[model samples]
Target: MVQYPFCALLMLSLLIFLATIPNAFFTQACLTTGYLRADAYQTRCPGVEAIVFAGVEQAVADDPRMAASLLRLHFHDCFVNGCDASVLLDDTLTFEGEKTAAPNLNSLRGFEVIDAIKSELEFACPETVSCADILAIAARDSVVLSGGPTWQVLMGRRDSLFANKGLANKNIPAPNSDVATLVSKFQNVGLSQKDMVALSGGHTIGKARCSTFSTRLKGSSSSDSPGLDKDFLASLQQLCSEFDNNNMTLAELDFVTPATFDNQYYTNLLSGEGLLASDQALVAEDGIATRNLVETYAEDPQAFFEDFKTSMVKMGSLKPLTGKSGQIRHNCRIMN
Candidate 1:
């Protein structure tokens, strides 16, 4: 037996401790601090999800389109800076807010809806609930209210003190994105290509501005977009021409059952009715992986629902402020 010195034993113990740590802490770091759990507010703010659902139900009752808008808020917020509610901040003289970002300006509705929900939450639980968690819960409720899948949303996220307007513009996948671009955008936020395809299903219930897919219409190029259906192309052209390319003029992302959250979006992509260039690219221009996913989801609604819920829960886990790292803002629009 060999005898080891006290310093050698100490060094060996230190190395063993370091080896026990997760490789992700060194290789792929969580951009934000903290851990979130499904039962984060079980005691502090019990039935918080139900309260948020009530608010979302009322909002969706007022306008069915709001379901899509609220869902988009969670996507936009998570893509920029983890799951922090930085996207909720309004611009101030001292600092810029994500609301004015290129990807968000004039679009990204449902702010007033969030404010209304926040008001109710403040009355019920005071500052115990974070605005970030509200966005997540509201997103899930919005989907369920629209006849989509329901998932367990992990809570305990805290509101961001500042917004990243530049990241908002650069990070959110643009409507004109191709399959490769979409994959890259999602990957930048630590999401997989499968997650990207599934999350894009959220478009099943939303509307897009005419400007988003105007180029896919006739005459923008000598030839129509690849895999663009001829009849769908003609209708879109008429719609755009009628609006004179007005950005305010809108078209449903999934025209068939537009307000319903269903697998019809994938079915549309399979038949080439996908509205945005980024949307159709999944099945049209893309090969193998994404196209296969598009096919799988189109044929199996249950598969789509399961994958979508998994993706939503995964996306919600992005960099969150946990363990008292951030404050629970009294007003979602401003830091507390």
Candidate 2:
């Protein structure tokens, strides 16, 4: 009789102990098994999507170029550290951030807009949301507000505690890359050649510094190689010569439609009017598959929109830290 009572007491104690465990522990465990989803924040942070879009829309209204800047911010963040928002970190005494990397130093913008969105979110939900998710959402909203294709962005990505300046410099494809090099870079990041061509169409709404494309305007080294249009090259030279400083002069990447996200980027490429060497390389002789993709997108805006939507989702899915792996950062620029 005594042994039976002791066994019953032990079992009851174990049940009580298990019941005391926090629900978050189990929720975190479940999140480890799958990729993030569009509704990840539906319960934890209601109305988050609206808050992000409103902030992005207001910023774009103030400066139309902000749409492109935010989109580039997402791309740069993902390529370096897998959509972790490490690019948003500011340089501190103990930590060096991605802002000073070779490719991003003066090129990347829109941090203030991100900060504004985060402030609004913090007021509404406190520590319930992550900065990485905010960036992903802001990028999508930027595209939609700029007349680009809209897609559902996955959430629940946690902010990274560390930033990689070296990887940012190394992984970002250079403006002067050849077709093969561009293809290789995309492949290394698990993006297909078609994805590369489609994503490059983002150039439809952005501007590039003169220093990024001035070499191509100097004339081709080989006569057999195709070059930009003579008149287009002259126009570029004139626009880029306004300031003695090479980096200060800016030219629209898609001259036909600089503010709209459309197939005009591919159309411009077809006409030998691509602003950057990497842009032209997609249609170069060696870029058989990429050239085909460029022509297809130019001829069919619907196809480009569909494929770009898929590619953006695919890019955002790269190596996210979910579950109990990383923290939901209160401040995007600092580690908690």
Tens-digit per-residue lDDT, 1-336, candidate 2: 445688899999999998998766554444565558877766567799999999999999999999999999999999986889999998887768999999999889999999889999999999877888999999999889989889999877888888988899899999999989888888888898888998999999989999887777566332323546767777887787777994578899999889999999999988988888899888888888888999999999999999999999999998898877778788888887
lDDT of 1 at 247: 61
Per-residue lDDT over 1-336 for candidate 1, one digit per residue giving the tens place of the 0 to 100 score: 999999999999999999998644532122234667777776567778888999999999999999999999999999988998999998877779999998999999999988988998899898878889999999999999999889889877888888989899899999888888988999999999999999999999989888888777755432557877878888887777786546668899999999999999999988878899898889865456999998999999999999999999999999888765768899999976
Off by over 4 Å in 2: 1-34, 220-226
Where model 1 places Cα greater than 4 Å from the true spot, the runs are: 1-33, 218-222
The per-model lDDT (C-alpha) reads 0.87, 0.87
* Model 1 pairs whose backbones collide: none
Give residue 63's error in model 1 in angstroms. Answer: 0.3
Q: RMSDs, each prediction?
A: 6.5, 5.3
lDDT accuracy of residue 287 in candidate 1: 50
Per-model TM values vs. the true structure? 0.88, 0.89
Instruction: Return the top candidate by TM-score.
Output: 2
